[model samples]
Target: MGHWLDRNIVEPGKLPLLLALAAFVLTFLVTRVITRLIRAGRGPFGNIRPGGLHVHHVVPGIVLMVIGGFGSVAVRGHGPGAVVAAVLFGCGAGLVLDEFALVLHLDDVYWTEQGRKSVEIVVLTAALVGLVLAGFAPFGVNELTPDELQSRSIVVTNTLINFLVALFALAKGKPRIALIGAVVPLVALVGAVRLARPGSPWARRFYRHRPRARRKARVRAYRHDARWAAVRNRLHDLVAGAPDR
Candidate 1:
């Protein structure tokens, strides 16, 4: 285990990334537990208010994130400084994402149905970062051969192709596919060739003139949503506690 860590993570200068991911996930779990307990009125945990102003944890999270970001940039990546910076950044990210709905709506929406977005975003972020730590490079760059890496033209061409495919997937309202495709070109190719969602912009522009295509898209979208909504809700509830009512 130690050999694996040193060889794969620490030696490749990815210790900070692993640390940040661990801290981020842990912080989120801890924060959720406390918040859930507070909501149940079964713990000593309570909201913070100072000078009649409710102080959200996201404030300190932002401060820590800035400090960690700048500190990492300023310090050498050789030693514990990187780890400290990673921890701070992770903690900050956790706190801020815990209330992501608030940031998006510019109001407190925690415990509401809208708050489910926070869990979803956090899960997405964690999964992406975990993929990176597992040796998946962004935009499938890691798939390039050593010789290909030396050819700027080849690199640029590959990147542009992959980006376009991923864009197409996104336009088709396949966000999950697009996200994964950003790391795996094959995923993008598959998504690019698939049908668009019914209400997606792509369907509006291209399928509007084709009733058969529009109907197919709509049916597919409905079936997909019906199949996944319950699972998605349960996952959100498990991660961030179910929405109140």
Candidate 2:
């Protein structure tokens, strides 16, 4: 175990990244627990307010992010300073993302259905970062041969192709797939070739002239949502607590 840790983490200079990921996840979970407890009125914790203005946690999060981001840039090597900076940045990111919906909508929507977006974004962010920690390079660069990696044109071409595919997936309303596809091109290819979701930009523009395509897209979207929406919601509730009715 120690050998694997040294080879995969320490030797590769990934200790800070690992520490950051751990800090991010732990901060998010702890924040959620505290927030949930406050919501249920079962804890000593309560919302922060000053001068009749509700102070959101994201404020402190932003400050921490700025400090840590600069500190990480200023500090060299994977030393104590780097590790501390990484942890601070991770914690700040967790706090900011926890209130992503509020930032996105410019309103307090933390306990509303719209707030689920925050949870989803946080989960996606964690997954993407975790994939990076697991050595999955963006645009599938890790899959290329040493010779291919050495060729700038070849690397650029490969990245361009994968990026376009991921962009296509995003246009098809498969943001999650597109994001994952950035690291795994095959997933983006699948999403790109699949029918666009109903009401998505791609579907609205391209399927408008094709009645059959529109119908099929709607049907597929409905079926897909019916199949997975409950499971997704349950997972969200389990992680972030149910939103206000």
Candidate 3:
């Protein structure tokens, strides 16, 4: 175990990344527990308010992010400083993403249905980071041969193609696939070739005049959502606690 750790993580200079991911996941889980307790009025935890203004945790999160970001830059990814900065930044990210809905809507929607966005974003962020940790490079860079990597034009072209495919997936309202596709080009390709979700930008723009296409898109979207939405919601609720009715 120790050999594998040192060989794969420490020697590769991925210790800080591993630490950061651990810190981020732990902070998010802890924060969710406390918030859930407060919501249920069963804990000492409560909202922070000063001078009649309710203070959100994201404020402190932003401060921590600034400090850690600068600290990481200053340390230049070496020594103990990098580890500390990584942990701090991870903690801050957890807090900020926990309130992502608030930032997105510019309102406190923590317990509302809209707040589910926060959980989704956090999960997506974690998954992407995990993919990185698992050695998936963005834009399929990891797939390049040594000779191909030496060719700047080839690398750029490959990245551009992958990026465009991922963008198409996003336009089709397949954000999860697009995000994963950023790391794995095959995923992006699949999503890009699939039909756009109903009301998605791609559907609205291209399917507008195509009555058959619009109907097909709507039916496909409804079937997809009906098949997976409940499972997704249950997972979200299990992780972040159910939103208020």
lDDT tens digits, residue span 1-245, model 1: 99999999988999999999998999889999999998889878998888889888889889989988888887866588989999999999999998898899998899999988888878888988998999988787899999999999998998998999999999999888898889877998898898998788899899988999998888988898999999999888887888989
TM-score of each: 0.96, 0.98, 0.98
Better of 1 and 2 by TM-score: 2
Which tens-of-lDDT digit does each residue in 36-108 have in candidate 2? 9999999799998888889899999999899889999999755799999999999999999999999999999
C-alpha RMSD of each candidate structure in angstroms: 1.1, 0.9, 0.9
lDDT for every model?
0.89, 0.93, 0.93
RMSD of 3: 0.9
Lowest lDDT 10-residue stretch of candidate 1: 71-80
User: Candidates ranked by lDDT, best first?
Assistant: 2, 3, 1
How well does model 1 score by local distance difference test? Answer: 0.89
